[model samples]
Target: MKKTIVTVLYLASLIASAQPTGLPAAVHPAEQLAALDGGFWLAREQHQLRQLDGQGQEIGRLAIKSTQLDARGHIAAVVDYGSQQVQLLDARPGQLQRLATLPATHFSVEALCLYRDPQALLHAFLIGEEGQGEQWLLSASPARKVRNLSLPPGVVHCQVDDASRQLLLVEEDFGVWAYPADAERPFQRQAILLKQPYGKLKGGASQVVALPGGVAVLDQAGMALHLVRYVGQSWQYLRSVPQAQERDGIASLAQGILAQGVLAQGVLVRDAHTAQWQLSRWPTKAPTKPDTLPIVLPLAQTDPVAKLGDAADDPAIWINPSNRADSRVLGTNKKQGLLVYDLQGKEQQLLAVGRLNNVDIRQQVKLGTQTLDLAVATHRDDLALVVFNIDSDGVVSELGRIPTGQQDIYGVCLYQPKGGGLEAFVNDKDGRFLHYRLTMQDGKLQGQLLREFRTGSQPEGCVAHDAEGVLFFGEEDKGVWTTSARADAPSQARLILPVGRRLQADVEGMALYHGPRHTYLLVSSQGNDSYVVLDAQAPYRYRGAFRVGINLDRGIDAASETDGLDVTSANLGTGWQEGMLVVQDGHKRLPDGPQNFKYVPWSGIAEALKLD
Candidate 1:
């Protein structure tokens, strides 16, 4: 490798005596600074911001209580403590334009930092002195959250490492802690160990600066610059370069890249230089391969649910036997009833049956002398199975409700045995599953408990392969399990996929895609906001996993926190010529409406994972 300034990192930390003799006019003092790569800096003092050049010359300034810039300094997130608002600025050189402003918090703010995700969405993370932490999506509306952090008091500094996708926090009296930066991920943090014998911080790090793939820690007590590199999920102490740590009391450490028109591509750390902060640079290896996220966007989305706030739960597709293009989607509005939509995602019918949770459909099923399709959902109010009949014209009407001989009934799926009739599998909150034999007696559909079994934990989502009569169910926090779906079959369940690696916990929903070329079992890996696909036959080869992303052209947001999903192999016109997959959009955004379902053609999934 070619020699760079990184070879002599120790010499780079030395404070040069040369000052900025020819400097820009006066200012209070650089209280906080974020230096950009191209000799630009975001210097904040109280509610005013001063843009500084490499020679410590002020170009422009703005008014903001607290602020931080992104990794490349292309954007800045500012907090107005007085107005309780957070703003985003287009921080590209001279154009510090105010892009958007929204309410941040109602309480007093403590610390703030800016982070950009792999999708190029800007986010602002705010921490309160009373241990309140919020991550706001700054690209559009500023405030939103998945995991709201309960931080410790006095944590005054935080930085988001875009390279490693980790959030670094500085607590002054305690060692630094690193956490997964994505808000969709669960809240988890690990204390980064950086005590290297003589270079250890007496109490904790005085200042920590995030580099491309590493972090530079300044120890005021021990007088050292500790550089730690992030290697595969954890941080490793590389080497601590000795330096005289000085507390100038004028400003905190500001870090940036020195590349454009400069002598080298190195980390630039500025210290107190008379009236302005001087610069010191050190080089390191460039960032590794770009992060290839596992995300899959939907082709179209249905209208937002009528009822707001987590009302939409699961979905089922009713394929029109006469005209496949007219097939309607049956989605459960947990707060209302069932919602039926056509292939174009418009609500066709709304059945005010009851508070329905999950839903499934068995097309062309025998009910008495009629060959009508049946849609069933678990009714929370009745503790029963609410059944619906879909006519050939794709119109859905209430059939009857069969009280499930259980409490708190959850998910339900339909199956037909090779030699026999239709069966429904419904589960309780405590892992109790009951299999019922459906019958159309006296023109009223009813269920008779045939057999039952219980898992170790709560299980909801389940789907049965009609060709094989094998049932697949998700044990939310555990994993997916399979068993025979026959009415007279024993409850001999077999563990298929355990929750780990690719399949995260709370596995919410499952669907089967019976394509001409491939039959795969798709499960909603709700824990990570992604879906897992496996073979339908024995061994169940793990095909791959993907996430439903936002549709920019259509202005539909990504789906997350999915409770239930359903798919069909019948061609549904235009984009869904190869069939379609419908998933519940748990956390709806991009206008922030009630929850809805997203539709993705099988071709998109096949192309994304490189499958047939």
Candidate 2:
């Protein structure tokens, strides 16, 4: 018998799936124009305070090269270094008056302090510094001369006490010192050390306020708030509040710590007694209820991205309001990459994107005769806007990538003008949103830079309705801000939906949905595995929350935090490719581990979301 030879050939052809028939087929190269960069630039220019109004609508606009609001939020002082003029406006009254003026010089004012009591005529004092550490003080009135004041080294900011007689100087090192307003010499440096001069606090202080009976201080870390009481001779730590700090609206009261904002609602009363100090709201005589823990639905996937150890965040989902029954999701995998999936729990495609910070998608607005689905991917280094064409055959193609400089881009949105051809808005890491227009010419897109807008510090999330001509942006330390593309050349922006809740995690992702019952907003908490569903209409109720938990195949890592989510319900034609919830599974790569990515089905997530 001649030897028997057994050979196995596992040769399977890898063919691209034929474009789904019945839908529009997109033309190649002609549809290639990355709009993400256009979006980022628009966010940057629109980040400023475009207009300010008081109690009602439409008031005279406040325009200045630079302006700073006082601590009380009552007055805004604008001294245009270039114009050599100073103006004061009653922020509440919309009252603009030329308070005083200054000579054109290299020096500029940095802060405005007003007396707590209005009876005092001394409009507090304004402190500023110039070349060679030269310090000058000006009277709130313009007629007053700029008095030279001898100040200590590294005086970054200044504040006044209730009596306006004592000046609180926040040193560059973040140390607090008290100097008499009439003192001739620099501060006699009686520093109020919160932690008894621990090995030099990191980052230094940002804000400091004197609390009732004690001084409340914010650390350089920008994370915790501390209260120090004068224990006879030395400063003693009374208590340190983290989750309930000012950013979250929890303040210290005469009786105890009063927690306000979002953590105070829903529940009748807290656990009453716990290891942590408790503050009771007066139900009968108790305090009012505080916002309770937001409702969350955990996807519960244990894979790397959904694992607790992974530094994941910023999740968005696309859902068809007409048919909530089927939806799809697109999310960023933090440093890992971006993952996409269908509504039936099947992985469609996994692109090797680097450190994808955010993923946003909107219906292809008809630009000329072409309609394209605007898909944007942002990274820490640059903004990539890849337009995908939903061709007549229903096939999606990667058209092109819009590239900005090497900087982090966080938020992205499509602003579809009432007419056609969409303008994309993107929030950059530098705290601004840049706008760009996607023009369809010769069967292709040519991205043209439109303009830029000022926004809050560290803008991380954005949602826009090009058809409505409105744009919404979110900040980590600030609230949700809105701006109109249809507004004047200056572009009007304001805080429309203030985030009353002080979140441990910064608001990173936002999705807008118009439904029969109401509009809905889904926000992602990047620091923790939590998502808040808010009513888009009426009172904007706290609808619920969703997170990544075990039932969703996410392991019991107990440390998973949610980031980036995009919900789409293609079954009902919400402009999504199909029914899928695209979510970014924030998973870290192990030293010698396999790749990282997670995809959850729309039906699978529905079950988890319905857990209540």
TM-scores for candidates 1 onward, in order: 0.73, 0.44
lDDT value, candidate 2, whole model = 0.43
Query: What's the lDDT for all of these models?
Result: 0.71, 0.43
Superposed Cα deviation of residue 188, candidate 1 (Å): 9.1
> Best candidate, lDDT-wise?
1
How much is 425 displaced in model 2, in angstroms? 0.5
How far residue 317's Cα lies from its native spot in candidate 1, in Å, is 0.8
lDDT of 1 at 44: 66
- lDDT for each residue of candidate 2 in 539-562, tens digit (9 for 90 to 100): 456555554432212221111334
Candidate 1: the clashing residue pairs are 47-64, 296-547, 296-549
Off by over 4 Å in 2: 1-328, 333-337, 344-346, 353-355, 379-384, 390-396, 405-407, 485-490, 497-505, 527-529, 537-549, 552-560, 568-612
